[model samples]
Target: MNNTLTNGLGLLSLVANTGRAHGVTELANMAELPKSHVHRLLQSLVEARYLEKDHQSRYSISVGALRLGRELLRNIPVRRMALPEMMQLVGEVKAALSLAAPFGHEAISIAHITPDGNLRGSMESLGSVLSAHASASGKLFLAYLPEDEVGEVLAQLDYSGGGPNAHRNAESLKAELPQIRARGYSINNLESGANMNSFAVPIHNQDGKVFAALGASAQANELSLKRIAELAPILLESVQRIESTIKEENP
Candidate 1:
């Protein structure tokens, strides 16, 4: 373990999370590090362009961090390949779209897009979690995991949240996996959020294993189950394009 790197990152995170600048002495007090040590670490970060020091001798996250973030987003093949198609889908369907992949027992959104002026079903809120048993994308991801892994992930899930239609336990949700697979999509009908109906389809890798889930969400009145059925072909076509793009770029 490189203690220097770890401590530097810890301090950088503390400053970045606060969304403001901090002087070395203030950061040292906050991080419980020696003032001189904090100054040295901050100087190193500034040299690396990860932090910028102003005339006030306070440091804040800099353009280098933004560069790294942009690079990270570009390098995520699924998110990169899916974004253009997601944008097109948003134009056609006029709904919010999200790309989610399974992470532990939850489905975390890697990308989110919403039509202009609507925030009801947008999944852009930081730190929002999709419960594995209830969300459309979560259920689609779970439906494709191996049997043993599914059981393990299900055991770790928290079924206490979600709407009145959500499954109360693993057994109930587990029983629905086969149907989700057979139908080629998953639906969250007031299960993850009240008055919101979200639908998702699996995005498979070159080897045909599900890699992520592409989802759409909107107020139930706007995206009724009937409308979802009408939109299925379009969504699947987008998935096909994304998968083809991935194979071409990565192959």
Candidate 2:
């Protein structure tokens, strides 16, 4: 192996594979790296396409590391074309809408739209994950995920209590899948927090594989089961627009 692979990232594969990025100090401690050596090694890896920096200066595997995935979606037909329509859906709801894409061990809010004046509260809390089980988008995400990955997250769940949907167990969620698929939307009620309701639907790519989930989140005052029912058709229409756009772009 080359020096960069061996001495730099190889010793730190455990941390890299952990999926959570680290800073110089935490990575050094985790990898038993000396303070002096950590910075240089991380710098080298960052330069060599093995690592990337977040806004907070934490390091994680870079997009360059996902070349195979890039190739898979190189012309990622759906995500590319769905932007305008997804934005329009959020506008129609006059609430915060977001799209969460599956990352290795987590999800990323790949798209979100907040108009100049929104009826619901702030959406800044998104783009970061709290619980993969509690949020509507998360449920849609986990529910449709590959079986093994679903097992991994469920296995690591802290069953003690109190999270997005702490009351639910894996089996309960599994049971809900068919309905979510049947209904074409995932609804989460008072699960993320008191007086909140979130709803989501999956976005399928050209090959008919689910690529992301589109969701809307709002305070209880903003969304009632009644309101969600009213909004459902519009949202599904939005999802259709996005899927069609993606295929058009990629093809």
Candidate 3:
């Protein structure tokens, strides 16, 4: 890890996540770095077109960054390739479906769909960030991470304000990861919201690493542990198709 490169990327991530402009001093304080060093990194980012400085001398993410993000979303093969299978699964299960990928310490839904007959109160929204310690999709993401990386994300997680069953700290969540991995899936039984239950299975890339998670959610009355067990084969079949598609395209 080159310190200079790491610091520059860290500053970029901070600006992008906050969605607000900040001055050099504020960013320095937030990142816990020297003011002059922060300023130099911010200037370098500006030159690289990742951040823009206004006349007020506050820095914000640039159009260049937006374009890059848009381009990456457009080119994400899984989101495009998984749609047909997702639709099929939705029709079979009549539950909302989501495709999420790991982003930093969270899982972000890149795509979502509601089943026919309009399942009321579906919680997943496009671009929504799921709490990594509470949501099935999020825990699945954490379960597949390298051990040290999981520790880093756990350290940064905010454990406040989840449902009654949500893990309150890193230790409890860490204890559950091995079981999630062993089973090759994860479940959230009212862990993120009232009456919400969900399960997720891993989607691997060509390298056989977890690339994203395929998940389904519904009200607890509608989605029980037994129902999830019955639906697991459907979810895993779609995952197989998605992973096979990725391998065909990338290989």
Candidate 4:
């Protein structure tokens, strides 16, 4: 890769990671690139439809970029590959299953499956965003992040959006992350929503980094901490299967 291409890709990554629009000067300052160089790269990206320049001259990732992401996801096979294992886990646990990914400071459900019968908890729909501080899937993501990044994420959380059981401040939440890491999973005991309890374990990619969270949610009355602990092995087993499948497809 040439310097120009490298710099352009870096700038694009910076803008996409910010999850917000930015002006050229701001982007240049953030990227520590020359203003002129940044402007040229931005124009190139806009021309390629990888980014869009707004009326205010601010730039953001465009629909074309999203299309590229969707195309990549379509080929990745995680959703299709993981569905069988998810279904098996859901059947065994008799709870709602979810696959979620970190989206900035939030966790968004990418896929979900509810067990048959009336004993079901409220499940976040696909694309539904939830407080990372309160949800098991979100907390799992947070636990794996660098400490500084976790603090930054916690600073942005709306404690009230989490329920009364959630840690209300970063300090408290930070203290709990170690335990989650040690346990290799996270639990939301009526934290995200009343009577909704969930447990989540990380699904790793080929590099062993957390690629996503695989979780199960049920009514608190139906799933207790002891029960969650008992079912965790099953959840972890499914995660391993998903990870192995991802490795096979990606590698």
lDDT, candidate 3, 1-251, per-residue tens: 99999999999989987989999999999999999999999999999899999999999999787666567767888998887788777889889898899887889888888867332222238678899999999999899999878888888899996898999999999999999999889999989997899999999989999989999999999999999999988899889998889999999
The regions of model 1 sitting more than 4 angstroms off are 1-68, 117-123
Q: What is the lDDT of residue 219 in candidate 3?
A: 95
Report the lDDT tens digits of candidate 2 across residue range 27-132: 7787775868888887777787778878898888876766534464445444456566765566578777776777654466655666433322222543455356
Tell me how far the alpha carbon of residue 47 in candidate 4 is from the true structure, in angstroms, after superposition: 19
What TM-score does each of the candidates earn?
Answer: 0.72, 0.68, 0.76, 0.68
Per-residue alpha-carbon lDDT of model 1 for 1-251, expressed as tens digits?
69998999999889877889988889999999999999999999999999999999999999787776567566878987887788778889888888888776778877878776232332244225688888998898888889888888888888999987999998999999999999999999999878889999999898889988888889989999999998877899999999999889768
**C-alpha RMSD (angstroms) for model 4:** 6.5
> How high is the lDDT of residue 153 in model 1?
82
Candidate 3 overall Cα lDDT vs. reference?
0.89
Cα-based lDDT for every prediction:
0.85, 0.69, 0.89, 0.84
Q: Model 3: which residue pairs collide?
A: none
lDDT of 4: 0.84
- Expressed as tens digits, the lDDT of each residue in 1-251 for candidate 4 is 99999999999888876789999899999989899999999999999999999999999998787676567546645667777787677778988888888888778877778776232223227667767788998888899997668777778777767776998888888889999999999999989887899999998888888868888888999999999999999989878878878888779
lDDT for 83 in candidate 4 is: 71
How many residue pairs of model 4 clash at the backbone? 0
Write the number of the candidate with greater TM-score, choosing between 2 and 3. 3
Candidate 4 structure, TM-score to reference: 0.68
